[model samples]
Structures are given as structure tokens and as C-alpha cells.
Target: MSSINAQRLTVLAGPSGVGKGSVKALIQQHYPWVWLSVSATTRSPRPGETDGVDYHFVSHERFEEMIAAGEFLEWASFSGNLYGTPRGPVERQLEAGLPALLEIDLQGARQVRVSMPEAQLVFLAPPSWEELVRRLTGRGTEDAATIERRLSAAREELTAEPEFDHTIVNVSVEQAATELVELLGSPVKAAH
Candidate 1:
């Protein structure tokens, strides 16, 4: 098989509680060959999150510096925190012909569409709005105010579904991961 180009880069985005992380985890576990871009964030690492693995935790000043230096492919401020994808690593992956996947927010996805028009934007939607509410509240990690803010953002995000090239309803993590991999035009690898 030949190497794929930037056209193979897939951006997975959806509402706050749509199981985007779960689907991403499944892909990472089963498809080891897929290059998933780790985003840089100004938010402090949550419990069990590694610096370079889960996210590239950076200081707010450093993130600003990166933005000023034109290092990020896309960046957005969400819930008072800045998150962005570094451009260099993504470019390197595409240059090497590896199919790269970016799990980002709706704003970041829109930025990617403008910056890299050939990239495929995939929206991972929840089965229903009620289910999405349940998932967000069930987490128990955020306060009530934060939850309300997320729900508001989710409502707006859901309306933007038509903007994406593909929509995968995340009823099941495994199934969603499989659909995402297929959309990337990469052969699914057997689960290890």
C-alpha cells in the first residue's frame, strides 16, 4: 500500500458529552498504527492524565506564545481554557504519509476545515439530547454551572451537524471507532 497524504487526515469533533473520548480510546487500543494528534492545552491535567500522552499541558503564556508564533493549526478557548493542535507534528505525519486523526472541539474543527480544506471532518453525535444530558451529568466531575454551560454549548454544536462530511452517532464506542477508522480510509486492524 502507498502512503496517504493530507487528504487522509480526519478531524473527529462533536458536542461535549458525545463519547468522543471513549471512541478515541477504542481506536488507540485497537488501531495502533493510527497517529492521533495530542492537543496542547492551558488547562491543568486532570487526575491520571500524562503530560505528553493525554495532552501537552502548557502554561497560558506559552500557549499565547505558540499562537503568536503560528505554531497551532487551530486553537480555541473553551470553558476558560485554551486548547490547540500544534501544526508541526501534523505536517510531519502527513509528510510521512501516515493517516492522522485529530480529536478536537467544534471550533477547532471549523478552523481545520478552513486551514486544511482537504481534511475530513467527522461529527460524533449522541443518540439523543436526553442521553447527552445524562452522560454529562453522570460524569460528576464538573460543577452545576459548568454542566449548564456545556449543555448550552452542546445545543449549539448539535445544530452544526450538517457542516461535517460525516456524522457518526456514538451509540457504542466500539462501533463508532470502527466507523471513524473506515472514514479515514485505513484498514481496520485486529484488536490486540
Candidate 2:
């Protein structure tokens, strides 16, 4: 691939419960060449979530400080929490001629589009609305009120599908991961 293509940034985004994380995990395991950007968020860590691995969990004050210092490539308030992509790590990855992948929500994706026009946005959609609902509820991580809020947001996010450059229907995690890797134009280094 050309240097430009090697450094191309890809944003994976979609409604909640679309299995973006699962697809991302597969890519990380199978394609170690693709650099995935870990986001910083003010939200408290969920069960089994590590500090630097899953997210760089920070306090609200620190998140605000980052925003004021222009440290983020893109930041947004979602589900009453602040989440952002740190600009430094992504810049370093691109400088090293690596394809960078960002798995973020719809709001963060929009911000990335404006900040980095060259980014390729991929929408991960569920097989069906019913399946989406089931996935959201089945997680059993959040309470009923939170699930309802996510469902409402998912409805809006689904409408924004046309905004994305490509749509990957996540019928299977392995299939979706393969499709995303193909989109990035990155060769798989190993398969696990």
C-alpha cells in the first residue's frame, strides 16, 4: 500500500449494541498490524474493564482540561459522559505509517469526520431492529432506564447510516471483522 493508504484512519461507528467492540477485538487478535486507538472517557469503568486497555478512564475535570488544551482529535458528550480520542497517539501511529482504527459512537465519529476529512467511516449495523433490542437488553450491564435511553439513541443512529462511507451488517462477528480489515486495506499478520 502507498504511504497515504497505510496511514489512512478508519472510524468504526454505529448504534449501541451493534457489537463494535466485538468486531474490534477480533481485529486486534487477528490483525496486529492495524493500530487501534483507545479513547479517554469520564465514565466509570465497567466490570472487567481495565484502565488503559478498555479506556483511559479519567475524571470530569481532567477530561475538561484535555478539551481546553486541544489534546483531543475528537470529543463528545454521550450518555451523560465525556469521551474523546487523544490526538497524540493517533498522530504518532499515522506518522509511523500504520493504519489506525477508532471504534467510537456516532457523535465521536461525526467529530472525527470534521477534524480528519480523510477518515473512512464505517457503520456497523445490526441484523435487525429486534436483534439490536435483544442485544442491548441481553447485555444485562445497564439498568432498564439506561437501556431505554440507548434504544432511543440507536433509532437516531440508524438514520445516520447514509452518512457513513460503508455499511457492515454485523450478522457474525468474524464476518464483520474480516470486512473491516478488508476496508482498512491492511493485510492480516496472523489469525488467532
lDDT of each: 0.90, 0.91
Give candidate 1's error at residue 186 in angstroms.
Answer: 2.2
Residue 45 deviation, candidate 1, in Å? 2.5
Give the worst 10-residue stretch by lDDT in candidate 1: 1-10
* Model 2 local distance difference test score: 0.91
Cα-based TM-score, every candidate: 0.90, 0.89
Cα TM-score of candidate 2:
0.89
TM-score of 1: 0.90
RMSD of model 1 against the true structure: 3.1
For TM-score, the strongest prediction is 1
By summed lDDT, which 10 consecutive residues of candidate 2 come out lowest?
Answer: 183-192
> How high is the lDDT of residue 146 in model 1?
95
Residue-level lDDT tens digits of model 2 in 1-192: 223266778999999999999999999898888889999999999999999999999999999999999999899887699989999999898887778999998888999999999888999999999999999999989999999999999999999999998999999999999888888775444533
